[model samples]
Target: MTCPRCDAATIAFSIPAALRAHLPDDRPGAALCTHCLTVTPLDDPPDDTPSFERVSDAFPANDEAAVAFACVLALLDSLVLYRAELDAVATYAETHGADVLRALERLDADDGVDAHFDVARRTRQLEQFI
Candidate 1:
């Protein structure tokens, strides 16, 4: 599956073992991290959803389906919060980074000047990469 993040296509599939404990014993499946260990599936696959779809065969990224899902994820954050997330994304964008997902992790830091400092340094580091 195309990692819904950086779009680096890969066939690696399966959820992390830590989370598999929560999965139903009936089905044989896994949802491993294609990126970082940040976000969660939030729910099982829809009833009719197929196991895999070829990205190469799908519409271009400009299509409504792709943009809508992505935009919705982005709009879930405040502008400030969004930037903080982006700063994290920008950090990972350089080397082995998972930009979109990790960007939000910075928001989890304790509130105060220390948080701002961490954000700033990370922002600069991300900027260098971009």
Candidate 2:
């Protein structure tokens, strides 16, 4: 995997058995990029780097995007499956569709780009209602 911070190639580091046992998914350990001194858990992406060390802003903040998606989800919770509700969903899809597509494109283009907010998955969730 590439380093999320510097976009450098990453080297895997060995983790003690004690730490590996505690980690979920039977994951091995963490990786480190000597160039940037970034240490990320084996499962976590390099884009999970500290905000201060972030290399780019092409991807939306996960927290902010999650909140936005949650709000849309909340709105969905109360929506009745009717034409008006469907229209509202359609309007939302129309408004955000392009942005979502572009984000997905960026994600596809770069492994360093993190989906911190799981934007693609959440967008799909919203789209299903449309």
Across residues 1-130, which tens digit of lDDT does each residue of candidate 1 receive? 4434444432322232332333233232322222221122423433332222222212123222322222213323333445554443333332332343333233323231122124344434434433
Off by over 4 Å in 1: 1-40, 43-77, 97-130
Q: Hey, what RMSD does candidate 2 come out at?
A: 13.6
User: Which residue ranges in model 2 land beyond 4 Å of their true spot?
Assistant: 21-26, 43-130
- TM-score (all chains, Cα) for each model: 0.22, 0.27
Model 2 poorest ten-residue lDDT run:
66-75
Query: Which lDDT tens digits does candidate 2 get at residues 31-122?
Result: 54434434455754333333311423333455333212212322332334333543443344335332433443444355554433454564
| Model 2 score (lDDT) | 0.40
